[model samples]
Target: MRVLMVSWEYPPVIVGGLGRHVHHLAIDLAGMGHEVTVITRRPSGTDSLTHPTTDERSDGVRVIAVAEDPHEFRFGTDMMSWTLAMGHSFVRAGLRVLAGDQETAWVPDVVHAHDWLVAHPAITLAEFFDVPLVATIHATEAGRHSGWVSGSTNRQVHSVEWWLANEADALITCSESMRDEVNRLFGPEEIQVIHNGIDVDTWPFAPRPQTAGPAELLFAGRLEYEKGVQDLLAALPRVRRTHPGTTLTIAGTGTQLDWLMETARKHKVTRSVRFVGALDHNALVAAMQRCAAIVLPSRYEPFGIVALEAAATGIPLVVSTAGGLGEAVDDGMSGFTFQPADVAGIATAIRKTLDDPAAAAVRARRARDRLTEDFSWREVAERTEGVYLAAKRRVRHAYGRPTIIERPLPERDPGK
Candidate 1:
């Protein structure tokens, strides 16, 4: 099947998990023999309205970067104008692709959009090309702000999300919790729960070298309010009372860094906490390798990919019972789950693992086995392909016929 993926972010221009998710999914789809084309916004400082640059990866996926106008966007107006501009750019690129030589003039069987950022363009292109549309709701504006669309910008985003869910032929979410949320909020007709996957071989699994000090606890992700990093910091003092040699390492950068540091100071655990800002891929893997255990204390996590990555690295995980973090890991068999914002519970879970390294290692091994057995890119791509086929069938049935494009292809040599 030929697929066109629309996203606002991609690698080297990622602000969150959406870009990484799209990158891995697209590559795996290509590997599965599907002709995948990705359309995304180019990074800042690039020329607006410049010709889109198309790069074909060795995995057979073609990525087309369309420049976005940086100066014309502000807070509340950003999403609207951005989507309009991106939709225009995508339409232009689609025309160019359709105008190419016979061998290169390919049309997509399905147009898949990730999140609300690209919803407008995805809907427009699907209608223009007369194909099926699939939209993946990674998270909702209401979910992110705890069911409160506080400001004008957030309300606008929420409206767009609702429109996208209603417009798509089928909806896809990363977890059951997300599916329920989408159903309650937007009421999509059909929704599929496809968990996010990771590459198991990406992280090295060798035992971390021992250093002469406390057992290091790692919390890697955005240091935001919803992430519950502050709660993790608050739990550190309690954890230290039980295991004085234990330390907490907070990685990732966000708006709450300063407040988190202040919280640590207030808790008087500043000495026991180390705030290492953002980490690249290699550094993140290395940190996972060395940490005694990985803790994700999220107040609201639609789907915790970090927990999956940690489990893949053979690290014992202690995640909060927020959205999908609890679903990602077994309570006791694989790892422990504590209630979100429960400082005592978080500390107790961490303390138990620190006290019994053998038990923790056993659980980590189980988690790793589960990750390898169940969560893999191959399985994810196969399931995603199934969703695409299902959506296509639905569209065909609705229209009472198969989609056909009668445009002329440019004449050129077949073996160009």
Candidate 2:
């Protein structure tokens, strides 16, 4: 089957989990004898589609990057702008390919859009091309840091997300918690839960080299105000006083970087805090392996992909009982939990893992076992393919028949 994958970010231009998810999904889909064509917004200096740069053409998959108009709003950063831009680009790219005899001319049987970033294009392609559309809502605006949408800008973002969820043929999310939230937001059974997964082999399996010390705690991801990084910083002061040599390693760069740095300095624990801004995949895995435990102090989280990553890497985690993250981190088993904004609770959870190495090790192994059994990219992709098949059937039933083709063909090209 031919599939069109739409996303705002991909490798070399990723901001978070969405890009990584799309990249892995496309690769897996292509490997499964499905022709996958990915359309994403181009980073600056990336030669745009008039000269369309092909990032890769592995197996039967192709990637097309289109330059998008970067009109920035106060709150709209990488995701919002790129999503809007990707929408426009997807329509444009679809038209360009449909009009020609390009390598991607076979046309796609299904349009799979990742997150709200590609929702615009996902909707447009579904209507304009009359194909099955499947959207994955990684998280909701309400679930991100529990912030209120007051202004026009905030409303616009929320509006886009709502539109995508409603317009798509089927909805996918990363956890049962998110599925429940989406169901409540859009009515029951509106969203399907497909937990996030990681490449187990890529992550560091063993802990980082350590000395007799207090312990090291990790918090990785975007440095946004809603991410509750400040809470982690506040917790650090307390944890440090109790465990003398405790150190906090924050990996990842975001809008709240300066404030977090200032918070560390103000708490007089600057020496114990290391702001290792933005690690690549390998670096992050290594850091996770070394830390005593990983903490996600988000105000609200949809699925907590990082928690899964930590679990897969045999790293115990401490996640806030925020939104969907609670579903991912099995409190007292895979990891521990605390109230969303409780600084002392966050500190105490980290201390638990540090003080009880034997128990922590047990949880870490269980976490790894759980990931291996349920959350591998291969499993995720296979489940996602089932979603695609269901979506195709729904579209077929709605339309009464396939319009452009008789059946889903094996591939556009018949012979080698």
Model 1, 183-229: lDDT tens digits are 98876647999888888888656553445567999999987777988
Put down candidate 2 lDDT per residue, 1-416, tens digits, no spaces. 88888887876568788887888888887888888988776665344444454455654568776664444522244546645655776778766765356664557788888877677777777776678889898887655524344444446666677667666788898877788777765453767788877877777578534457668888999888667888888888788777888888999888667777888888788898889888877888888888888889987787767777787777777889876677766889887899888898998898888878878888888888887888888899899999888885243323222111122222211110
Cα shift from native, residue 194, model 2 (Å): 0.7
Q: What is the overall TM-score of model 1 with all chains considered together?
A: 0.89
lDDT of each: 0.81, 0.74
- Regions more than 4 Å wrong, model 2: 44-52, 69-83, 98-104, 145-147, 207-210, 392-416
In model 2, the worst 10-residue window by lDDT is: 407-416
Top candidate (lDDT):
1
Candidate 1: residue 8 Cα off by (Å): 1.3
Instruction: Tell me how many clashing residue pairs each candidate has.
Output: 0, 2
